[model samples]
Target chain A: MVLVALLTGGLFLPQWAMFIVTIAFAKALVALGLMILLRAGLISFGQALYYCLGAYAAGALGRFLGIADIFVQMLAGAAAAGIAAFILGFLLAKYRGIFFGLLSLALSMILYGLLVKNETLGSTDGFNILPSTLFGTRPGPAWVRYAVLASAAVVSLGLALVVHRYLRTPLGRLAPAIKDNEIRVEYMGASARYAVHVIYVVAAVLAGVGGALAATTVGHIDPDMAFWTTSGEFIFITILAGTGSVVAPFAGALIYEIIHTTAYDLSPNTWQLSLGAALLIIIVFLPQGLWSLVSKMSTRYARHP
Target chain B: MRKVLVALAVAAAMPAAHAQSVKIGVVTFLSGPAAAPFGVPAKNSAEFVVEQLNNGQAPAPYSKKGFGGAPLEIVLLDEAGSTTTQVTEFRNLVQRQNVDLIIGYVSSGNCLAIAPVAEELKKLTNFFDCGTPRIFEDASYEYVFRTSPTATMDSVGAALYVKDAKPGVKSIAGLNQNYAWGQDSWGDFEATMKVLVPSLDVKTSQMPKLFAGQYNAEISALLSAKPDVIHSSFWDGDLEAFILQAGPRGLMKQSLTILTTGETAMHKLGKQIPDGTVLGARGPFGPYAPNNQYNKWFHGGFVAKYKDEPNYASYQMAQAFLGVKAAWEKAQDANGGKRPSNEQVAAALKGSTFEGPGGTVKMSIGKGHQAVMETAYGVTKLQGGKLTVTNVKRYPAEKVNPPEGVKSADWIKGGFKAQ
Candidate 1:
């Protein structure tokens, strides 16, 4: 209900705010994918591989194939990323800890190296995509922006809600159990690697969808989309939001954008100072993340009242 | 009675001083690797230009008060994020901030992202320093304009300078940071060299990753090739780091090097820039910019404020801001001294010509929507313990730039011509 209300209300807000919210949610979707790993006590540092693939797939379809249909382009991106992840996840799921993280990072860097080398893909300049359409009719900038916003909101909320339900299932509940004791999970007659592989593919799809939506919103894609720093940012948001609740990543992403941008805007000279200070405070006071503070506040209010 | 009538007439002749201030949004890298050499100087120049214009403190033609007698309001935003973030910030500046004119974007990718959006929004945008020809080559837009030479001009200018000055330079090598700017620059130089210096053979090329800040292997490769010339388009800290590393290895002694944006970093790089290295400030910028009272005032004021020499990016920023001011003034003139609408300003700018710190900018190129400007570059030598570009040669805008509506690559292949 709250998500629906906010989506509807976002229409009347300023265009820039809508833009921020739309992009924030797109990034949150990616962070939510990272949260899956966070819950499983695994962190894949190269999620940008899927993210960049999705963006490039959507961008190429729109730019070269003239497929301006938003759903078709975005789904194409997710499908492409899903297939790639499915093949790679088998090998990826076999590893754990820093080795797994480094392998993912290597995969992303390989993509980056290829994109940077391909002059036809704009080399470093990147290519721009045409405006997306609703159904069959091409829309103006205002309409396109709103369409992107609506899609961002609906998809993000839908994913969060669906993932929320998934958490109650035994397979979902086994994630943390696998993290806590993989040997125990194996003794129970289920392969933890299979469970991890499934989650990996799901996370890949989510990141693909996120990157596609981001490409749609930005109307541009480049090799930097796969850069390690971009993947690092997703990991940072994952830690900041924690895996406590499905709603947490969205909230964390929104706060992260606000803080990161505020620091940049307020003090360009010492912008790092402000962001570093905020992250330090959050890590020190609420190790689990802002979600823990919110839960604690809610429980305290319930007790007092 | 005569005195009172004269005062009233004078007041009526000028537009009301109370006209609404035109809001200008300036976006550049406020915090990032690109900031130090390109973004910081450009933003600082924007600040100085806006300040001088707002206060009627600027020198001639630009002396017009605050873009047609309206006090200028300026907003500076950081273009320090993904291409998506820059696009969003552009929308924010235009839609939410309500800026009439946006002058920004040093990154070629960032500029390309915002170009079509500006046309979609119907907001006037001026690109000061982005060197990608694709902005106009890939598509045409009525609202977007780049007021400086593109990569074609910069690369071709260096090649021409070498051909004219060092005719015997047969084998040329390249060491560019791997990115859009580097690839385009190197590609254009090779294409131009194919025509201008037919005997020129590229011995080796190296593309170190951007901001890699390490170039031992690449420098060694170039040195081993023993090319007569080395061409590069690296700028900012990357260029500084490359030169600092490559200089000690005797790369300069073996090869005649051209730094496309070398002059911009001369203030800091100073004496370390070995004598006789060719330098291209992207245009006739730095100490060797245009010679005029306006140039003197700008250079002097920049140094007085920032305590450093104005660079190519700085000149480009001042030129872009001045172009906007000139367009508004022309539009206002056509309006019989009234504030011109955005369309009127765009129309006036389309076919207009304006004097800048770097000679003249002809906005009549690419069908009056894009600009073509003459660029000057030369070999560097130390003068009184400061890095200076000498033997400077200026390439006419028509000589280096593809004619309006010509694809640069196609133009080069067809023969470098103005026709």
Candidate 2:
């Protein structure tokens, strides 16, 4: 059934429909990273900084550095984000809870300020992503588009399997332990900082992947990717998914895209109100997120089985 | 934070000698996602205008005689469009600086938020470029007038051009920013297109969240829609991204792209934009056909100053200062030449027809006191190794604007009354 749905999604969607799906998928990738950080009791409100780092690296590489190979660009983006995460993660990993959130936010804002002030990277105006090439051929847009969707699907599925596998591992289980009782983990002679740093680097790499995917899809990057509110949006998407699974963030992202597109289309002026109302309703009723409902239904069926 | 506070404090420390310098408060978005495109140009234009004003050559009609011997000084206040920041800046401008006149604010939300305060304080407001039709839906403010065309005028005019020029256009794919101006532009354009061409089909419309600069998914969907025509009102970074991605992929080649706010980018990305593409401005560009005498004069002076042709935005700013000058002059003429009071100047601005660079504009008070003005249309082309628009046409404001009794916010709240 799931294969049928995935196949249907792959084959049936019109071009624009697939595009929306890919965007949702990219957003979900970033949101999943936020979910991992949150699982470790670290609420990151600066994911956009890493996202921007990845996107800028991809955009700059693709446009200026003449590296149009999608994989290389994506890898460069991930490596760039991972490097920054490694440095900032060392400082940020020591902090927990709200302090972690604020520090991350501050770090992202600082990047935003730098990007805005520097005219060479197009400053506040932002730079465009050069056309991405597939293999050695300049593929047509539809081909490139389908490739994006396929990439999103593969990445998402891989992440889902990886995250589920992670939960079964000692490190993954220990992450939640740190969330619940950090002192107890410290008493167990495990360095929580190291675990946090690893998770931070992992999440940053994921965010870099998301940014690279975004650059490929949008063919542009801007300082807005590093803005504080953008980071908040990543956190919001993560919270909306209830940390249920890697796929949940993707589901939440799809829902967000649909709602956002519909609201803006109906009335661009009043759509903000619609988004606020939706967020309010979602917060009030389904506090655990839409994925929580899906998980509950599946659990009930599994128990009966 | 300290630097920002210090700047605010410095603005606060300006002397209250109202009779000396002609203090004008200008508000615009200086932070957040939208600033790169809209705010920067607005500030630059204002600075350029002030430099012109201070340089003793006030263009043609804007002689030094307009300022009554007091040099024009601008106190720039950043509204940034968020209500929280807008309110704070509004208080600071009014209470601390005690500006003589207020201008600026490009976002509809900021304009709607601050317009009421201007009305309450009876401060003369010269709106440059807030395009939410809701502003003019209410009763016209005596103290408020906009120099830029309303969003409806811009969109409806483009619709007319599209219907005539690209008669074979069927399916339309739309991408607009998620905001009031974006909504009104989409609504008016769709409505106008439907009215003119009954068989016109809207294939897919996407209003992605505002400032959601990442749009490959939406782009894919939009391209998939296979529309004959695509229209977008995405400004600044969003617009740049859309163009860069869509242009090389033959999206521009396949679709009849109608860019409502492409003027800001035409010079920068001229070659990338496909020929035969339809572009329009919120107000008339200097090169727009149906050239009136005012356009010639405005064009000549603008070229003389900037060494480049005046885009619609620059022309709009010029017209705004012209409107303010006209109102003050009319008031002074009525008040026996001693400089008009704020109320008098406001009354002069309301319901009064004034000749501007874009042609003649009249204020009709609607919901939010929006301004309805002429629209310009053109075809994109590369000229002299630079992006130069050609085949430019100008439609009178009356043809595209809502009929006088339509009660649209742009028509209702915006009116001019020459005292």
Candidate that would win on DockQ: 1
Give candidate 2's total backbone clashes.
47
How well is each residue in A239-288 modelled by candidate 2, as lDDT tens digits?
87788877789899888777765554343335567777988799789999
Runs in model 1 lying further than 4 Å from the true structure: A297-305, B1-19
Per candidate, chain B TM-score? 0.94, 0.85
Candidate with the greatest lDDT versus the true structure: 1
Best by TM-score: 1
Residues B1-419 of candidate 1 have per-residue lDDT tens digits of 99999999888864555347888988888788888888889989988888889889887877877998788877888888788767876877787778889998998999889988898889999999888888888888888888877878888888889888778778989998788888889999888887877777889889888888888989889988999889998887888888899888989877888887788778788888888888888876776688977788789999999987778889999999898899989999999999888888899899788888778889866678777878888777888887777788888888888887888999997777766
Candidate 1 lDDT score at position A299:
94
Fnat values, one per model, are: 0.66, 0.00
Compared with the true structure, what per-residue lDDT tens digits does model 1 show for residues A1-305?
87779777987977777777877887888899889877787889999999999999999898778887777777977898899999999999998889889999999999999999999999888999888776778877666677778877877888888888877888888889988999999999989999899888888988998888888877888998899999998998888887778888899988888787677556656667888898889888888888888888899999999
